[model samples]
Target: MSTSVVENLGPTVQNVPVTEATAAPSALDTGLTLGAVVQTEGTTFTLWAPAAERVELALIADDGSQRNMDLAHTGEFWTGFVPGVGHGQRYGYRVHGPFDPAHGLRFNPSKLLLDPYARAVDGTLDYSSPLIYDSSDGDSAGHVPVGVVVAGSEPPPPISRPVHWGETVIYELHTKGFTKLHPDVPEHQRGTYAGLAHPSVIGYLVDLGITSAELLPIHHFLTEPSIAARGLPNYWGYNSLGYFAPHAPYSSSGSRGEQVAEFKAMVAAFHAAGIEVILDVVYNHTAEGGFDGPTLSFRGIDNRAYYRLGHGGTMYDVTGTGNSVNTAHPQVRRLMMDSLRYWVEEMGVDGFRFDLAVTLIRNERHEVDTVDHPFLAEVAADPVLGRVKLISEPWDIGPFGYQVGNFGTPWSEWNGKFRDSVRDVWRNSSDGVKDLAYRLSGSSDLYGDDGRYPYASINFVTAHDGFTLRDLVSYDHKHNEANHEDNRDGTDDNRSWNCGVEGETDDPAVIALRKRQMANLMSTLILSTGVPMLTAGDECGRTQHGNNNAYCQDSEISWFDWSLPDAWSDHLGLTRRLLALRAAHPVLRQWHYFSGEPVVEGGRKDLSWIAPHGGEMTEADWYDGNLRTLGMFLAGDALRATDAVGNALTDSSFLLALNATAETRQVVVPDASWAPAYEVVLDTSNSMVTEVEAGATVPLAPRCLVLLRAL
Candidate 1:
């Protein structure tokens, strides 16, 4: 017996080794490829089912003809090779084993199982069809998608001009939602991979000054039966089904294996444009829900091995999903590592943002341990994966899951605290000034002395899971009735402040206030000392009708509305200006924590907190719960950085003042004469620029921000 040309290299899918003793009876033994591995002569299909007494390959022909072929089992793997089968061949596996759901051994031969390592799958899943769960043989063949035998192809060369972490700006978006309604994209190409890679889309991102595009889950996912039956769709794509394959629906071409090439082409295009592609991956769990859920690939192949089985076979889910992937298991870890490498090496993606990543770092007993987790250490040491960016959601629903700042060096995390604290200050909460100061200054309290830089905090005031910047000031409560969960599914603690009304209103005063607040949040995010991730459509005020959890609203509720509102243009312009300011000022994105100590002798301190009374902030001023007025002085001459060409960089010293109260506050500049004159760079209240004399008292408007550059 000879091993297949393409053998399972990374830790074997099963405990079986790639030796002649563990090879199938056939001369061409495809050892543990675990899917339809297409060859020049034929296609060899393999599956891992250790508990199966027998396994059969059901090949569905192009003419809808069904051919059932027996497979030879050697150790834990079953292999079968068909001479005539070639690329585009559709097939699935049927395993015969014990079917006791209570004991977590569910091997129903009647339920045609999908290949867990399928690179491409044809057709869509009809969850309601009986063939999906029970044996309907030929009757079920049309209802369920079959794995397509795709020929291996090399990916384009890696991006040469990768964005550095210090200067990277992330734009988080949904693949379909981002361009689904863009006028520039063709109707046929809208919401497709081709559309996203279009020159028009690329140009918009470049103009927005975002170095990377962090897409929400684009992995092949299944729409939950409950949500689909209710006429709603899972717009977020969090429910992953096939980890190795890109979502076929996102491609303009048919699902007959063209999606793989289309996805790769999209990555290549982004790299060509010098923009990095970051995928928001969902590996914490699969679409297969709780114990009674559908028998998907993982559940049918190796239920006890792939998923964490709690007391008496019940799933110990930490991701809020019913079944959590048993990452502690060697085979499961291999599956994840292989999938990740495939995306980067074979698909050309630059990085990944793990959703509910805390679940992946848990021990075998389902205990969270960021320091000692085998997966974390493996990722840190992986030569291929270590070079690419690795971001973690940093929290799950389990105990000790909120390990935000606990991640080691080289790993950044979604700063949930930054989002909350920023919201608190603008909402005019008591003692919020201190929280705002901490977050705006790189969240030192969270990442301080942890061997991580300011970029470790991926800061955003609004994300896809919550209200958009527009809705934050428009709705006092979540109006998620459109989700069909009676508005009870989303979190009630929104921390949002409606300008004056609960929902949309015509009052000019309320609308004006809301616009100002949006500007405030955006300014704080870009000008702060950390990496900023702007949610798609947030710059143009795309709203979800107050539905924070628009995960299931696949219609206009989730799509990016290209038809911009009147105020949305202003919003977009403001965002562009603020990002431009961030790009110009290295002091705003300092790599090290500011110690209030001067870098150059006789120079100003790197940073200093200022009170409204023209003096440095005192202990008593910081403790004032009602203090809503604050100012910060940034020393540009201190800690100067160099450009890529090794040329020394210079920036202007800046003084930023904030007045979150209902009345104007006079902010006095320090009398130390850091600069002879200060020019107002931006004012959120008026969206204008002016000039002020040094040591002058600038009257900042109520609930507004003023940035002044020393001249």
Candidate 2:
């Protein structure tokens, strides 16, 4: 906001002073609102292109006719007021300037740039058209995505989520793929935002006890030319084209500014169902990719200031997407912050999960600035972004990018170590139970030392990018031939194990084992002491046929198959049961990490790891690499927390035993100090819920998880 803040960003023009920056920062980003602002009588277009020699406004009508208008340059921004051009006016910009790629200034009036802050983006880019690139030197109006003017409206006040933070259950889902094949949803509304917000869909999530829906990238994106050439689409929507505009294709309503209203209604519907909407936002990179990529909004507007360019203006990509955004630039950061605020203030969304978030806070030197950075500093000082939830993927391909626990309190990170450790534990490949113990108990090794609590770790065994629950136990290697990249697109470090078979088989034994593995992993995910996130189709049986990299496959491979087959009914029921147990019990969800000591005088420890033979886990048990059996005892009375009504909280104690070895495990119940009696509430072996005798042995099948309640 101040001049010194700009100077502190970096030495390059990427962080130049507001008045001296190549791109217009003082007028457009410093105080003025960027993009199309609809007024009472007309609309005003504002853009940042301080290096441009000339700028013109192209207003396109419904019939495809356009009228040219000159924008008055104020030495800081190019703004023009077009009378009678209110909402629903499709438009693009033509900025005439130098086309010096060496210095990162690639402005070509031939390329019609979409507004960097476009509130509504309509239509798709004709990637095959040569005029869309700077090489053509011809008009690119019809071949590019046009921004539609949207009149701002007041969104309803956000509904308060009744669930506690500790009880949060995040369901990561695709906006369209979630309801694509729902048998109950109407045919017309299927696979659209309207379908996702249908009462049927909302009721399904409510019955399953989901607290939030983390939708993947509703931001408008473009299908990469390479993918398009292969007759494929970017189904994951990671290549962001418009940050403010909701992905138009996902809207059942029209895309001519109607997507905005439809998206708002969807949010309102989810909120009324007591489900918070958290967007899986991609702000680390733009669809305008590498140096040889197409001339999109940022590149044609101000390439040097909008992207992290290296020597000779080469794009510095850390997202593995060819180009990374220049958040170091004051205006670029403002664009990102503005998009975030707009989503919160206008869209009625609850939070965001920033994809490849570390790229957003990197300095001009392309190094991560963990402390005193402008991005985090602004987020902390802002009123809007402070209260809303902020999650980070927390890693990139850049140097020291694996900053899992580096982000301080008030932010949650996707726990990569938790996923790896849990996978290893279930696959019977873990060296010892030490890592699994830490992960199951909220990963205190990663988040404890920071000023954050147990909830800082967003624990998940399977996310959108990896194998689904069913596939995790059905495939040993990736079968990604459908991706068409010689099976080299997705990550090869998938810690999956085929249950005695490589692919789908008719053997009932292997099928049974696979389903049981899914149940076991789901149980572990829900019972863990952190915010649990479930991939969209994981609850039921959803398989990508070993295609872990289904980002380009929008067909049946990625959509949620809602038909509950006979094989997955048990697993789905178990998932619901696990979530219900989590919600009903207070000890299962703790605000703070377990102290492993008595919270009150003469009480059992809050948490204790027990050996199969009984009593505390000894050092020798931990030193054994083959020791895969683990028992965790949670004492209800030892928790130092209170209910929402401020009453001291107490709950029934629980004991969970997991065995991942070849031989079955028989865990002896602890002494009277832990629990007087125990009952089998859930078991992965046979879905049995029965009572166990006092101080009796609980039989756990190999690679099975059993949870019991202390009586």
Candidate 3:
């Protein structure tokens, strides 16, 4: 889509007027004027300069032609209506003011400044001593009145498509890691935004049934000083440099505005395919690390205002990324809120998953407060952002960091317990059946009340942070040797089992067992009563060569191999079938916690656990570590949807039997009042099941799961 086409697709839902600023007395009216040239109504511009002694809009043409349009100063805001200057126009503000840093004024008339609301920036930020704050000379350095002209242009391409929340299933992925080795993406477009938007990439996502792709941090970021010296780039892109600009490295076209266009095109294509786009935002910290770091946007703008400091002007490392942003500050909070609103309104993004969100909620006293935090409360209440799918990493590396269930209602979290518990139950040890039951039932122990539903807890067996599903079942330990960290990095407590073999093997038995284990993990994840997140490439059995911390290895160690053998194809097919089953069954995706009560009058409970002997589970049976044979009976009539008067809506029933023991056990089908005969729908012991006679016991294979539907 062209920029003009995007501009014509106007009036998004997030374009609400700035109500808070309009309701209050103008701060610019009482203070020195600051200039702003806002483009609205296509080809028309409005300029604002509060304390400018004189303001002029100098349009710099491509051939070095210049035209000075004198701006009109209204009540604090300079207004103008320029026709010829539309998209792709390069301009800057020339304002005359005192240049002082100690008293917080660095407005140089000679130094042309880019518009703060510029949708797209045009030039690269060349690192030089000129961009630093110097206090060497009296007036030229300390409060320098030097001409520092940095190249910039009008805001980038406008966002055309904005999908709603209810229709979003966010798939968080790293841009570079996603397409670094994508076979179909061209060599030039391989790690760029264009690559992610390619038909091949989008086709995979469409098949996966995910509605939104939540990309990891894409803001222009800097490699850490320590990491830079070792010649390592920040692969995660968590440390942001420019909020408005797209990361230059991910742009295949290399044009200043092309990145914006490409990113928008990606969103538009996804929207066209009925999918949303979410960004994993990092506002907790910046690339400007601690006291001794580069002075980027926020730090250069106002160090004390933007960052939390310790006693005697030291830096407080709350996010473990050095300087923690002082989101408690009013202006700092405005910066973050404005950034979020900008993405939602102008970038066509549907939602955001905040990284280190707890840091943003920290108050001025350096204490994390969910209630009093203005920024958090503002986002939760803001009409433009309130309805957006707001997810939180929900923790930081600070004191009392793990805030899993702390985020208030209308917010979902990455359930770490779900990841660990599921992994432990299937891959670590089979002793935690009771713990696995809690996770499978939507983790009510963590988020049961406050109107939060099961979807609020995003359950997953594996994520980008750790081992892939294939690796989890194949490697007993993390292989971080490729990271050059001497295998010191990555978590040691992976709770993974090698299944009697380490890494890849030619042993057919081991390979077969691993594939079955992968199926089991995927089955549990999709069948669970919460939103399941499947890591990219997990369906095709992607492996990171046993490297859990492959964040630095941008080569094959992280790239997903789409090419698979027939066995792998079968596993992928099974994964797809499991996901389809989950989508088809209302009993599997219950919004509320399983009440364990019957919906039908005088019928069986909605769910009933059974022992190998076909009797209802007793306390002793549930607690027995050796007793791994378990069965669950789900009543279709009992799980029916109700009207205002609580009546049945749909009829479906099934039974799931799981045998985690080393020895095969007989799973007796109970002749209950609700279900008299059960038909085999899925049997992991064999490739397919034809039929099983009613009341005829079936021998469940060791470490196998079987599903049956009532006939």
Candidate 4:
């Protein structure tokens, strides 16, 4: 008789009815193992313990009762199943192993270890002596074997829905700071996952014309001991604890699975509104710091396999977080790749923005490989991940960290040069116009012949890490005293200038100049050729009270104030108009690099640089720092058109004039074969012109940018 037949019988009844006459199974079901049952049911668990001699599973109940289950091995995998124990059950594992730090193996079975496959972790980790091995004792060289089980439970199913890429405008935001002060969200839901998915929150994103919300890390993360002691939390969640589990602190509901469900619901609601969801992933390092740091998941599991260690088993501090991940190791590389795929396939994410991406491509010697790194090739070749948008921060704290345009083809990098150049041209002295011109034209000099398009440069003047657009024009220096760092922290060279006053004042002229500067920055960003990323609150003129580095402020200092004044409302209107203008014109968002020649036969040049007098630019004009006035004539018909073979293409003609001097300048309309008439489509001079006649000498206001169309 088969043991399966006997196990099928209930505990209350010894003999059950058997229809088949071929067999009569015994009551004792010793042959049917729990591991075999779990394997048959398509569920399995895996743990890495290179130092462990034995491992066991301990199941805990809500009423403090416990059940011990011995694990059965299948290769390196030790797995088992409790017939009635599944998804929502609370369980943990214990490993009996050595504590030889000199050999890089520190394991204490006395610690109740978290399952690496756990979808969610219940409560916060409590630091205790039982979690560590005493180095003073003789047994310290070899940790004693013991195990403790803790209570935990998973939540119910989530509402699943996935959105695609290409149509997504991701809004990167921190979970707590995003809705911590939102008046519409319930007090309990504030700063939680539930609040992020609330109808009002979703409505705000929809109103902003954004198609995707790229959230900062929500994974279980460790708060640095020093930061905790200073009464500050980790504002930027670069420190990760568990990859599969969601952070319990971000959950409004107490259930572990509820966090997962709420996160999925957030994606679903955004999808229903024709939006996508991308995640800003930090896989460069774990929360485990150097020698003095706590024993966490990766450190306790298989430190050698997970981390890049130095000579004599010392931790390598490449990520600036005490320890860097060994992506060169095949197993470590597999872990990262699997984590990314899991989020895309299971959680329905549209894309990923890799933090400190250069560190992930480091070779065996810990040197970053820009051209042919194994991890980079793996991600690019992946079928499930290939279609998704891959954005790289492209730099790290290591040597040769500035890799703005160094990433390979098919990867878009955060263009820091574009940000700094544009800011310097508008806010700094007049020595940056030449570099600004290079950035405005898709940064072709940086990404010219790499088989990459203009969009490969993700251009922006402001991001979450620096000043808001309002602060960029309102203050000259970073005021980080509110961060409790005595204002010594953050970047000293902000490249910002207060038109006249240092801070806010009742001076009408200063206020007007600041507003105009805001307009100038927005116009430059939108009109430039690249993928433009607007910081969420910048459009509405949100400020951080001059806090450039508000990493710890969870108060109103970080949240976006919804009730903006009428003046700010007007600015928002202008921002929308600029975006619409960018979307309306193909010349502004060209895919290919400017050819410099006439795009159309018998037509004007694809692009022509001119002086303020409307004459062709001289070599001397390009070198002069004081010559800030210029005109760019774009030939619309000169744009190349493609056929079925994907050849080069062309399009109509357009003209733009810019003047940064203290007085207005007369711009001449150049003679072209396309037409004799030119019409003004947009004029920042008056901010009210719909259209103007061509071939007319227009008086461009000081520090103004104007757009014209050929009729």
The lDDT per prediction is: 0.82, 0.85, 0.67, 0.67
Kindly report which residue stretches of model 4 are placed more than 4 angstroms away from their true locations once superposed: 1-43, 58-60, 63-70, 73-76, 127-168, 430-432, 565-567, 600-604, 616-618, 639-653, 661-666, 672-696
Q: Model 1 over residues 1-711: C-alpha lDDT tens digits?
A: 111111112222222234477434332333356677776667777777777887777777788666676676767777766787777778777677766667877676666667878888777778676556532333345666667778788796677787778888999999998889989899988998889999989998888888899999988888887788888788899999888888888989877788888888888888888899999999999987888676657787778888989877789988887889998887678678878988888888889999999999888889988788889887888888977888989999999889889887779999999998888889887484887888888888888867888888999999999999999989889999888888789998888999878988899999999999999999989989889999998999989989989999778989988886345889999888888878777887787788888877778888989999988889889888999999899998886578779976667899888888988887787774667888888889984348777788777789999888888
lDDT of 4 by residue, 1-711 (tens): 111101111222112122222332221221221111222233333344544666555555665344544554433345444454444455556555666666667565444456655666665543333333223222111111111121232322222433322223457777777787788999999888788888988887766666567788876676766666667777767787666666768889754466667776666666677666677788898877775566645666666767878876688777777888889877677667777776777676677888898999888888989888889888988987886678899899887777888887778888899998878777646672677777888888778768887878878888888889899888888888877778887888788888878777899988877887788788788778777778777888889867788767666778777676345987787777776666555676676788778766776777777676567777777887877677777776666545459865454567766776667777766654435776676666555255545455667777677777777
Instruction: Report clashes for each candidate as comma-separated counts.
Output: 0, 0, 12, 15
Per-model TM against the reference? 0.93, 0.95, 0.81, 0.84
RMSD of each: 4.8, 5.7, 7.8, 8.1
Model 2 error, position 491 (Å): 1.6
Give model 3's TM-score versus the native structure. 0.81
Please tell me which predicted candidate would have the highest lDDT against the true structure.
2
Better of 1 and 4 by TM-score: 1
Candidate with the greatest TM-score versus the true structure = 2
In candidate 3, clashing pairs total 12
Tens digits of per-residue lDDT for model 3, 255-281: 445667777777777767766777888
| Better by lDDT, candidate 3 or 2 | 2
Output the better candidate (2/3) by TM-score.
Answer: 2
Local lDDT at 312 for model 2: 97
Off by over 4 Å in 1: 1-18, 21-34, 134-140, 565-567, 645-648, 687-689
Candidate 1 least-lDDT 10 residues: 1-10
Writing each residue's lDDT as its tens digit, candidate 2 over 448-567 gives: 997888889999999889798888999989989898889988888999999899989999999888887888889999999999999988988989999988999999999988885445
Candidate 1 residue pairs in backbone clash: none
